[model samples]
Target: MNRLRTILFATFFYILSVPIVMSVPVSALFGRRAVIRHAHVWARMHRLLYRYIMGVRVRVEGQVPAGTYFFAAKHQAMFETLELQLLLGDPAMVIKRELSRIPFWGWAAMRYGGIIADREASAGALRSMMRAAKALKAEGRSILIYPEGTRVAPGEQPPLQSGFAGLYRALALPVVPVALDTGLVWPKHGPKRPGVVTIRIGETIPPGLPREAIEARVHDAINVLDRERRDYRMVQAPPAA
Candidate 1:
């Protein structure tokens, strides 16, 4: 039954995604927000899909803001997005440029006010992210960023890149650290496990502090949350400056 349900889930996602892909060019001609509104409605459908079809349940800790904030989450599984959208509403992600180039998901991301970043571009990437984030914030939107950048397996930690600190330094907005036991269930590469996934929204840490301090604190914050609730535990602290 689970396998059949998974197949249906894949089918539903692809079928709905086609229109979003085709509509990108038209949305591009209009404005990012115009398409973003459409995408928001589209993503809501995904929540229903996960809840009713997939039977996925989510539990969130801490608080989500009505205003704007920079949200950073540990990347492990697609389950992260469900909680993010549930908490912050329409999320404009700081994604790789590759996503913006694809049909539908990529194009709609661009047309939908998502921040498509170029890691190799160096200077320009920071500026572009800030601009996109600012625009989204002005429109009463929350931004989701993955500091670890990519999903990895259980017990493995991805190196947090420097761009996260740069963006925080530039924006100086409130930062929320989110942690989840997503990899345990919806792992990067594995058969889906049946169960509820746990997530927590940490207190908003303000920017304008030292980069090392901010990054280390966020790291520990997530680790503490994940450890308390899951099989994971922190092994080492950030090296001294």
Candidate 2:
């Protein structure tokens, strides 16, 4: 029955995604705001489908802060990617340039002003991402990035990618560290487990901190949601320096 439910969940998401994908071109013609609004609606619909079809619910810990800032979140599975939109309305996502080159989805991401990075481009990629993030900040849109750069096993801990640190220094915005154990129920590639995915939003780490301080703080913040800790408490942000 679980397997069947998983199949149904995947099918339902893809089916609805087609229309959203198709509307991208038209939304692009309108502007990034239009595309972002459409995407927000899609994310809400996705949350509904997962809840009704798969019995998976989302429980957020802390209130998402207002105004433009950086959100450095743990990437467990594809779950958080979809869930973040619902959580933060429509923050500018930091994604790879290759993802921005895809057909409808890519076009929408590019048009919607996602901060695009090209790892292969080395320093240039970081520069491009910083410039884009700064633009989004000016536009009063928050930015979200997976500090690990890719998904890891639920219980495992990995050092954040160097790009995250660079973005922190260049963008100079307070960084909100988010932690989630979605992978416990939604593995990177496997059958879906039924449970509530808890997203714990940590306090905002102020900018201009040394690299070691920021990275260590973010690393601990994101790992708070790991199963062993089992403490789902809201972590208050320290007073900004």
Candidate 3:
């Protein structure tokens, strides 16, 4: 049943996607509402897949941080990305440069809201982020950031990216730490297995937590979620929206 559903969904995606991707001067008429609507539809479909098809369930324990938070989530599985999309709605995402080159899809992401950053350009990238961050917030959207940049293989911790602290400080918004242990089931792609998916909605650490302190705390929170030790209360949660 899932296979049939997957194929049907795939067909629908490409049928609508090819023209958008292949069109010349793609950005010429990309409507903001269309991109936002389409992306969330994809997310909602995946969310259903994660729950019913994959036999995975997400449990959020804390409140969602309020008033334009700087959402820093640990990226062990692609699940975090989709869950955020489903749960938080489509807040403007800050993505990497590679996404910008993916023909039609990439162009759509950028035109709508995705901020593609050149990881190598430290100062310049920071400048771009500040601009992107500001623009997104102004649009009444939140910033979704993956501090580790890319998903590390299970049991491996990706080194922290250098600019999160700077970005957090600059944004001066409440930082919400989100932790999910979805890698065990999802395993990055191909056929997914049925497993318990757990996500802990952590508390908002006030901005006064120094950048290093904030980084350390959130990283530790994620590591603890990685452990999946016990179902403890998630700290500093944003109110359930």
lDDT of each: 0.72, 0.84, 0.70
Q: Write the per-residue lDDT of candidate 2 for residues 1-241, one digit (tens) a residue.
A: 7788889989989998999878788877887788888888788888888898888988889999888788999988888887897687688898877788887788777777778877664887788788888888788888899988888888788998888999899888999999998887888776886898899989989999999999999999999878345443224445569
Clashing pairs in 1: 21-104
Give a tens-digit lDDT track for model 1, residues 119-163: 675777778777887887787777888887777565555567777
Best by lDDT: 2
Residue 136 displacement (Å), model 1: 3.5
lDDT of 1: 0.72
Error of 2 at 138 (Å): 1.4
Pairs that collide in candidate 2 are 203-237
Sum up the clashes in candidate 1.
1
Q: By descending TM-score, how would the candidates be arranged?
A: 2, 1, 3
Candidate 2 ranges with C-alpha deviation above 4 Å: 227-241
Deviation from native of the Cα of residue 93 in model 3, angstroms: 1.0
Question: How far out, in Å, is residue 210 in model 2?
Answer: 0.4
